[model samples]
Target: MRLRAVRISRSPLLPLFLLISTALALWPAAPSTARPASCEPSVPYESGTDGYHTFRIPAALQVPDGPLLAFAEGRRDSAADDGDIDLVLRRSLDGGCTWQPLHVVADAGEDTVGNPAPVIDPDSGDVVLVTCRTIGGATKRQVVAGAVAGSVRRVYVQRSTDDGLSWSPQRDITASVKAADWRWYAVGPGHAVALRHGPHRGRLLVPANHSAGPTARSGAHSIVSDDGGLTWRVGYLSPGGDEPLALNESTLTELPDGRVYINSRDHDRTTEGSRADAYSADGGLSLSVPFRPQPMIEGPVVQGSVLQVRGLTGDEPLLYSGPSDPGERFRMRVRASGDGGLSWRPVWTVSEDRAGYSDLVQTGGGTVGLLYETGQRTYHDTIRFTRLPWVWRLLPELTVSQGEVSGSAR
Candidate 1:
């Protein structure tokens, strides 16, 4: 069977771009990054504290020097993925030290609406959120296998013009983004990216994953919009079959040199690590480099977040937040790569608790904000936000694979 694939851009400068990227990717990480002494996290949503059974899949987005908006799936009666879930949000006027009250951005009344992958349209400073909507009766696995009854899986979007104070209602965009044969679809369980450079500059990208019928093998793609969020299209579809790239819960960031770097969860876990990465030079419209396992950056089978943060002294490092412990979903570690998405070294571990899915957003200056699922018992108990100082760079000093001490910094 023929597989859906992206049309690779044939720019004359493509070879030069690949050469630069390859050098950066292979360059050894410097062992000189400094981590903060402690990450005093602020709980934005505690399970059962806000009349909800749980809060999971945290996604945070903020424009430059703007208010920090934190988003999550508020499960009403249970912690299960398929249930009465609403896309809830909170705002932080100051970095991330404090947060405002909870607000339900989109609620489909007893149905599920989540996976809030929010992005800012830099031209108008508008916040656009993309989420997946489905019936509460059907599980993700059931939907993937094409055995769903009521609304299997759909896509909805909302825009906030007043800095997250109110949304402009949920508008369905499933028809344009999802293909005919696609069985299961999901938008980012985290934040999206707005391109600032490259030929497709000003385009907004949402990295997503979907499954097909007959076999239900998962595949990753990019949902793109060129004219703000007014219109959408399927940008690229990663080639399927026997590549060990059954990516799920994908996240992306625009590199310093105007490229899209996508990191995804290996749902099938066919490789050694639970994560794989690729590069898209043509703004996420296609992958310049296909997905491959990144063994240096370790994590469990969980949703992770990545962002390109600006350092205080002109450095632009790509920061990734995920569980450092490959054995279990604990030791939420923050890592950084000075040369785009080439190499990574630890900045510091958030905690040794049962931490799992996490998302990262730059909170201005040299500090970064993290919204993650962590608890004393299970990762779904509560979702909290913390700040990390991004002062220095890193070159792998040690390679201790036990836990948090995966040594890039300390």
Candidate 2:
């Protein structure tokens, strides 16, 4: 291609300047980094169509260079939290455009077995899932009030070696993950995280919550496994004595600075919205940033999910998925955090219809997949999977005082 020249006032170095500028202008521009992606929302679990009465607590996970997995609680009887609930999953091999048939991951006869917090092992390439087991009809009120026995509210583990095509049998890990003093226990209703950096890389960290005896104080903690899914142990646990922060139903995300950030749903905190956040520097074994309320991260008193994505540049941007409605469970939105989890700004709204629990996973090629509960009649009517492109910044930046979310883990 011939280079075009621009004339200027006669100067001493005019010839050289024109030659350089013309040559540089003739150079081709860098290739565009834009990645075009789109997918229509597909229902993976319809309440009345499946054998189960209702499916809730959506969890989305994708194996590295493999298929995507969507998990939920298959309530056998009704949409209630209890009564013959099972952990179910659906696999997607075509970038979540379509899904396979439903498969039951864990079923406990007439008991309730749900809270599918799944994570893919970075070392073994296996999909590990942690779940909470409870009696069929046991309510959280009764269990936290110390009326229900601890044996009912237990924890279990299961894994899939063939990319979620088949899962191993449920192995009870309550003794390794749960405490004897706790009455009520629940694993993550969202996706768990496996560490990918630092010395704790390949560690599977599962966020959980429990209410202790006597006071029935609620606290958030992590159940960690180092040898893939072989052995498990309890990690950093927060105190819930008389304080306004009654954190539960937590989510985990690993930051670029090798720290684990946790955000939980607050039931006892009346101020600073209904969400609390903390950080762990020791690979989720202990807290480093402590638990504090996020006044800017506003939402309803429901479970929210946090995910760390590296496709965006500049900083370690994170994505949060939950209902945006401050008063009710409606209008599901995905917020963006430019600086880890310290601050967040609304980016995308997955749906404005009635919605509830949601899980977020970056499938690949700068695309994020969301599996959430949404329906015309109610949020529990069905579960759908949707994929959206990472459009980077979509709104103004929002931040909060660092002093508010700064303290000890205890």
The candidate maximizing TM-score is 2
Local lDDT at 321 for model 1: 90
Error of 1 at 276 (Å): 0.7
Residue pairs clashing in model 2 are none
Each model's lDDT: 0.78, 0.79
Q: Where does candidate 1 stray beyond 4 Å?
A: 1-40, 149-151, 391-410
| Model 2: per-residue Cα lDDT over 162-232, one tens digit each | 98889899999998877788888999988998897889998989999988756787889998889998999
**What lDDT tens digits, residue by residue, belong to model 1 across residues 161-221?**
8899999989988889988788888988899988987578789999998887577788899
